[model samples]
Target: MHIEDHPVLGKQLQAPVKFYFNGQEYKAYKQQTVAAALIANGIKKFGLSRKLVQSRGLFCSRGRCCSCYMTVNGEDHVRTCMTRIDEGMIVSPNLEDPVIRSDRDGD
Candidate 1:
């Protein structure tokens, strides 16, 4: 779903790069963010809500919203919208419990 040519911006000139998401391979251009790549690949659901367990996707493309949080490499809570796609970079959905734990109760 990538825009091959923008009326104002013209054609994309960046070279394509490969990255993995949820063990699946996808292509993206250099300097493109992970969220952008995922969206381009038709991936709308990024994570789920804690309380209601509702499906969450890219709400704010900016880094302000936490809706786009995902796991990258071995790190959790990585903002996909702010993370640039790198060659061979591994990305996965955040599988950890989304519940906010209280410090008083140790899980």
Candidate 2:
């Protein structure tokens, strides 16, 4: 859930923007970052660790940590905490494989 009324910022008044996460549609404020929107939507786990395969979530929230990495619009390894939300943007959990292979690779 978002902060409707911050002690200093007061009531947050922003336009709603629609985006997709894991094939599901979610709404977020225009000024909110992708990570903030996901948390507000009740999504805690952003992706899995490459080695341990453990769940990864928001940490640091300052774009300094890799814990909030997610795939955005076919781009992998995106820092959700630093990326601003955009309408129609597609976000998904990062895959274990850092390299994304396409059928064209013929692997």
Candidate 3:
């Protein structure tokens, strides 16, 4: 949940933006991240682990962990906590295993 009653940042003036999650439209602040917006809307689960199939959500909230990884605009393994919300953007949980590119493979 967002800190609407923050002792320091109470109800700051942030531009509103619209985005889609799993095809459903959602409203978010222009400066907010996808994870933050989702949490503000009471969405607890972010994505499921590819191996264990367990639900995961924002953990570190600092882009240090994979707990916030999701799909954004057809891109996989997106760190939602680091990605700022944009107008008309599409976001979805990463349902499958993330494809890791190895440096051994020629780029």
Name the candidate that leads on TM-score.
2
lDDT (Cα atoms) of all candidates against the true structure: 0.84, 0.89, 0.85
| Count of clashing residue pairs in every prediction | 0, 0, 0
Model 1 ranges off by over 4 Å? 98-107
Q: List the residue pairs that clash in candidate 1.
A: none
With candidate 1 superimposed using the best TM-score fit, by how many Å does residue 17's alpha carbon deviate from the native?
Answer: 0.6
Candidate 2 per-residue C-alpha lDDT over 1-107 given as tens digits, one digit per residue, 9 for 90 to 100: 87888999898846889999999999898889899999999999999888888999899989898789999998889999999999999999985776657775676
Candidate 3 on 40-60: residue-level lDDT in tens? 778868889978999999999
Could you arrange the candidates by lDDT from highest to lowest?
2, 3, 1
For residues 1-107, what per-residue lDDT tens digits would candidate 1 score against the true structure? 88888889998747899999888999988878989999999998888777787888788889998899988886778899999888998988865664456554585
- Sorted by TM-score, highest first, which candidate order results? 2, 1, 3
Cα distance off (Å), candidate 2, residue 56? 0.3
Candidate 2 wrong stretches, greater than 4 Å = 100-107
Q: Which is better, 1 or 2, measured by TM-score?
A: 2
Model 3 compared with the native: what TM-score?
Answer: 0.83
Better of 2 and 3 by lDDT: 2
